[model samples]
Target: MTEHRHTNSSTGGTSPQLSQHKHEPSHRYSTGKECNASGSVTTPPRPSGIHQILCIPTGKIYIGSAVDLRARWGTHRWSLRRGTHHNFHLQHAWDKHGETNFEFSVLELVGTSDLLRTEQAWIDRTGCAARESGFNISNVAGSPGGIHAQEWKGFINPGGNEATIINLQKFCREHGLDFPSMHRLAMGKSKLKSYKGWTHRNSVRQREYIKTYDGFITPGGRPAGSITNLAAFCREHELDKTHMVAVAHGRICSHRGWTYATGKRKLAPRTYTGFINPGGQRMLITNLQAFCREHGLDIVHIHEIKSGQRKSHKGWTWREG
Candidate 1:
């Protein structure tokens, strides 16, 4: 498993070191519980932090950080195992060297706001982006201390006019809004899709492109009416739009006996297919991240809920389907 390799300095010089914290990821496979170099169980760091993936054979380390380290690590292992890791170099290395030669470890524990800047410092120190050195694709950090600095950004308001602005920095300055924060959301870097009712539009894709969509609801076996606004309908009659949308899209069984009237919803391919029990009520979750964001639930606990390790999250029972 884990090798307790220490370095002379923070910037690794000769061989890649992984014994930064008191532990090293020596588990032959990621089992939700992280094991130390000495084979003792060490819980994965909490809140947020930086992590490193080290290829011992080539001394190439992939530096990354996440809001949830365990979940992020699980994702990395999952992707790498599936041979679909975004980092081709890392995947190639794993395919060449074998999984046993690669070890993952904690670089530095950081808060959510400090992730990017701290990671940048590590990236600069390690030079992980060097072609022959590491597996980092880009040397540029996504954020600086969780605050972004970019110009000529674009944004679209989800609630208001769905019009796109060419330059968000200038627009925010003229309107006296936070540009850095908006820029993060607009660049699709942050988890939150909207900030202050504004959705960040990517330059490559118009994600804000909205076509007129409506749904019908049947309350107590009676047609309520053609609901033009799904969200407002959910709020007015004590329903979750996420569920209602799933019903309209024909993704789930039903959200309180509601279905699509036009019957084109099934054509919408993206659907919430995961099942979750929120507040002891079973509902279909089309997007796990979206559901977690809406309910303010931590992803780590959600994993536990599905695995039966956790009974409830924030007093709401969750079940796997």
Candidate 2:
């Protein structure tokens, strides 16, 4: 039997492959006549802007944002297929339960900065199915407040407490964002407890853990034992606990995690700045040739030299290698 997955974005279908470039076309797909089939159209490039979510079968979900939903789902498709996202827990769940037990759905589309705000509000409010869909229900009610922006007194905030998947798609459409696809596993999470597993605290712990590993030393002098330990660390360090929660659990951590972990280059890959010749001297011909060879470029060629050009070709090189 063919396995199928669905996304809660604009395209309500199962994904086939993970494609990078956030805007590149995926090469593989299924030919079944499924509306959001495993394979149909070429992977649409993810657009720039907005928040998103992914619903899973186990009743557990992932809340996130993207400049491009298409690209994000594509990459996830690859990871899930490759068994990369399958950690010990997930693997065990799959073995005991099944892949069809979990499903992913998008909940909302907010400004990148607003993700934390909405997430915080959701965590604070802790009502409705907002976490499952990522939709800020205030937008549906015509609230004037921005996603995470502070609402002016008496102004109706667009992000309300009634977030849902359908509303999330509407929000994306209103904002011209590419909708994502839902991904479901055959099984459910081992445990399911609202406000217990995968809470804001867990999110914060994930971020703080990464930051700590990346050399961010909290004032506590070392990594704390757990979330409460983090609270203790923050207290000892005199950090603002509220803001710290936002920083630790917000979308910035997830986005930065992607930036730091994936992709070939750190930020901008290729760069070209004029060489810094040491000792205020011209480079030797052999040295230049060696440099070019190391860089896998063609050999040196005499293009042309202007008259009175004081170019040196000898004893003008220094190497620290």
lDDT of 2: 0.33
Worst 10 residues of 1 by lDDT: 4-13
What tens digits encode model 1's per-residue C-alpha lDDT throughout 1-321? 232222223322223333443333333334455556577777555446677888877777888878887677778888788776656678888888877777766666666777777777778888888878888877876532112223443555544355655445446656655655566676667566465446655533334433344546475655665454455456667888788777767677566666666433333334443344544566766667677799898878876776778777776565444
RMSD to true structure for each model, in Å: 19.5, 20.5
Please give each candidate's TM-score: 0.38, 0.25
* 1-321: candidate 2 lDDT, tens digit per residue: 011222224332122122121222122223222224343544333442222222233333333335565566555445445544322233334445544443333333444554445444433343223534333333322232223223112111122122223333343345443222110100122122111112122122222332231323234444333343334444455555445554454423322222212213323332223232435544334444456567554333211121213232222222322
Q: Which regions of candidate 1 fall more than 4 Å away from where they truly are?
A: 1-33, 37-40, 143-321
lDDT against the true structure, each candidate? 0.62, 0.33
